[model samples]
Target chain A: MKYRNPHIPEGINVTKRHPLKELLILLGGALLLIVALSWVFAEFGGGLARLIPFEYEQALVPDALLSSDADSELDVYLTQLSERLQKHMAIPEEIAIKVHFSGDDVFNAFATLGGNVLLYRGLVEQLPHENALSMLLAHEIAHVVHRDPIVGVGRGVGIQIVLSTMLGNPDLNVLGNAGLYTQLYFNRDMERAADAAALGAVHGLYGHVGGAKALFEVIKAERDRMGDGELPAMFSSHPLDQQRLDAIEEMARDNAWAGSGAITPLPAAFADWLKTAALRTESGRNTGNTH
Target chain B: MIELGIFLALLTLGYGFGQYAERRHYRSIIEREKRLNALPAIAARFPPTEPQHHQALVIGSTVISVDYFKRFLAALRNLFGGRVTAYESLLDRARRESSLRMKQQAETLGAEMVFNVKYETASISKGRGNTIGSIEVLAYGTALIRPQAADTDR
Candidate 1:
């Protein structure tokens, strides 16, 4: 009787060999798909995002930010400012800009979904005059006019879906990092467009461009205090401070507008409120040991 | 630019070390497998009819970790939803190594053959976010110990 080995098959090769050409082809195909998808999203994402209901966009904001006291002084001030600014610009009636004032001390303001704009107390307190504040507000309003926030969100979602579908679902950490990078890249271009439009809007309102330059100077001073390193221009979402000042001056010269004019001071009540707000923030930070 | 440089450096390191480790492991596995071929473990239900010997259980286990290059390849393969060939070699090496160890144990006991061989495999270390880090393979069998002529005469 003869014994046969069941595990070892005759004339069978167990080792697997993947040719280099096949791997190269796979990589090339994946790269092509990524590029094509990115271009498609860049071209059409804003139009699709605009189709989303205004109510839904508003709902995306946190409830805490929306639930402010009905007639707070800050609210009244912001409402009047937005209305005054809207009167000067050819704003579409369908898109009503709503302003929200946050007590937080972060030196930043942002335009968000639903034509909403946030004004941080820290940045508001830093402005030298009402005209400077108007320049900053105009920049944010331009962002809303262009529907940048929703467009950005739309682009982010589109990219995420494409990436996940192509490569399966990646870890949350990777997805988060990728989303941030994409947002920053999109924001760089959007910011520049907003800055140019806001220059025109501010010029229409004040007949001068000094406020824009002054606002950038304030930001530059803040950056200098923080000892911020020189980040590459391409990687930054906002233009470099010097570049923004230069652009404003060049635009003013080309448009034959006076770059300097009489600056209006903040109203007495608004100025008083700003002082109290700063004090409150200072005390809060001290108590929290955040210094 | 600095970040891109760092990422490329890490990839190069992973590729170099992974290839070296894989080649060394395959060499060891093939050499041991060839030496243990004559005493192959089998899944036969019954021992040989001519056998008048002692039988005892023998077991062997081994754990193998994945190299970084294999892990990177597996991650990319995960996107396309297909066979992860990078993991294929890792599992093959673990199974062969465990079986070789089992055969060597049987040889030490002066066993003629092993019967009813069974293999068990399990994932040991799970990598970050759905990747496999290491795997363990265990091989077991009943070794048929043949009686020596001098001992039978006594």
Candidate 2:
């Protein structure tokens, strides 16, 4: 009979094979691949970031200053809000949190480039409390801090400028019409960053961040009452629902503000002012429309 | 008077340009409609609603298929309203373009009709000032081939 050798190695196969060396080799290979990919992408990916196509030749002057046509008293209130924001945030002073009024039926607010807050008179009137207003303002300001608009614009590199020229601006009028596209154009990453900044700012300033959620609820309720033809501008820009609400709720819970009181509707005085102003605008609009 | 002559000359010139632009826009719209009508041949068949049994036309993001219908209304409003003419042309263009795209998508999906269709118009600009520019019209709808129950039963 042939000598049958035991089906076992005399020396252990594991001793000569070092796991550390193997891991290093694998990691080195991955790193090389990543670097090579990045290099290739860097060279070829020039304007590919701009997913949308727009015309650049028909460019028009972009307005630096927001149209200021509101009452002086409202202007004063906005000034105070800006001061408060300045003190609360560690961001630069140049980024003033001023309010620009939108004469529309929809209740909404937004942050423009830098720190300017565009507040719709209709939306501001719906705010139940000072904290609610602060929270909204802070949220928009947070968008400014995170440079969301800049990044969003950058991502739409080729088409954004052209769109900007054609659309004039992503203001109440434009956004009011296009909801989903605008949201996607803004990109989800920018939105997430703004959400984080807004939540953080609201907590830091008011010691309670629940106002963001409350604001949405109020908006939804108000929207339901108004019924059709007028969806809140926020819905178009910051599409909200259960998931978004839950995300904010989680953030608020995780960073529960130590001392934020229950946010009530605006103080009677401010409410009165807003109501009076709205009446004026509406009456003016009716008269103008009739004419 | 020379002034009256000048006014007539200016009016004629303005009318000529306006007519030219309008004719051009109309031709573009017609071409778009034609392309959209032929969409079914090129697109993947998609159900109008969810579930395999339902028949629906699928709409893609084409200049012919989907867009805001508001442009026509807005333009009409411009005829008797404020300085809104500035927005009228752009809105109309966006609307027509988007609708064409959506129609193409739907037709491609072999959809006979799209119901509960919503129109959306967005301004993707960096306000009045900023170097970068952007604008886009996106229209989408549930594609349906229709009569899913009858077809499925067959």
Candidate 3:
């Protein structure tokens, strides 16, 4: 009776598939699933959010974030410009556009819920002319009129919720930065539409679309001065500055609107107004009032 | 972005080291299995009574851990519902290693053969939220040793 363990072949229990191949396949599938899910969520959520009454969005606005520099020359000038642009935009009468001048040197301006637009001193201080200033103001108002902020926030929240649920970790913001960057990228289209609408408003107001390019030029110059690490168009909230400049040219030619006209210079007291706003903010911070 | 970087780094390190360690461990396991093959271990309940053999108990146990790479792969697999091949080699190596260790023990006791060989497997969790920290494979059997052979082995 021979009793012995015979040689067993290797690899019967374990597969020999290349780990990297499997990794690639799985990773590709996972990324596709996430991207597809995000797109669907954005579309559905944005559509649903738009259905919410504009009044509801106004009510949802956080009062603390909407504070203006108040009654100063800067505040009055920004509000007047916004109203001027709003007239050209043919915005709804129920919607009121409030422009807030934040004295912080943030080098950015953004429109948010409740028809509230915040312009930072750092960005406005760099504007080369009134036409450019109007362009900036008009672009934000277009967003407000289009109901972008509420819809965008809705899409973002929906994506965040779905991702957290999928990743099995509610605490961890799964794909948080990547998701936010892509969200901004989705806003790129909204920005383009706003840009086009703002151009039309500028042409309507000033009899030409000239110097509307200055807003992007100032932004591009500021971006350059900050130097490098510029986000690609796919990840950014707006098209490339060069692309936008080209888009402006194309729109002007297509509509046969005047491409070249007298460039309107900014108010002579503009710089002083910004400085005064800055001082007001400084004092407010120190006194712990009207922050 | 920083979290993503850290996650990739951990995955790369886990894969590189885990794969190398698994290959080396498999090589050693194969070599040991061949060396211990002379000591037969059987699953049959009864052994032939030949040469008035003596009986003794032999046991071998091995505790093997899953690498981070395999764990991540398994977790991902849970999302999609597929074969968890990442853990296949893990348990395979553990069971084979435990069986070989039992044969080596029986050989030390100068056993002609082992009978009623059995295996036990258990997953040890350290409260790490559904992830198994390690697995233990235990092999035990009765050895039929010749009295003279057992004395000579010592």
Per-residue lDDT for A1-291 in model 1, tens only? 333344464113333655233345544555566656754665467569978876687678765554332236767777877777777776766777887765567799899887878778778878888788888888898888888899887887777666656655342123233434555677878887877777777777777766677788888888888897547775577878888888788878888988888777777787677666566556656786331
Give model 3's TM-score for chain A to 2 decimal places: 0.93
> Candidate 2 at residue A92, lDDT?
49
Off by over 4 Å in 1: A1-45, A53-84, A163-176, A228-236, A239-271, A279-291, B1-21, B34-57, B67-69, B113-120, B123-133, B141-144, B149-154
Ranking by lDDT: 3, 1, 2
Residue B43, candidate 1: alpha-carbon lDDT: 85
lDDT for each residue of candidate 1 in B15-110, tens digit (9 for 90 to 100): 788768878988887777777777758888787877586888999899988765566566655556676676777777778788888989998887
lDDT of each: 0.71, 0.51, 0.83
lDDT of 2 by residue, B1-154 (tens): 3443554465455445644664587588766666555333222233333334344544334222111222322322332343333334444556566666676656655565544444664445447333222356565555445565346546
Model 1 alpha-carbon miss at residue A30, Å:
5.5
TM-score of chain A of each: 0.76, 0.59, 0.93
**Winner by lDDT:** 3
DockQ per model, Cα = 0.25, 0.01, 0.43
**Measured by TM-score, how close is model 2 to the native structure?**
0.42
After the best TM-score superposition of candidate 2, give how far the Cα of residue B88 lies from its true spot, in angstroms.
Answer: 43
lDDT of 1 at B146: 74
Tens digits of lDDT, candidate 2, A1-291: 111112333223223333234334443543343334433332233234222222221121133345543566766776677567546766744443456665555567776554456788778777766666776776677766654544444534433333333344222122212322443535544556666666666676666775667666777777678775343434444545454567777777776654346664554577556666667667767786421
Per-model i-RMS? 4.1, 31.7, 3.1
- Residue A261, model 3: lDDT of 94
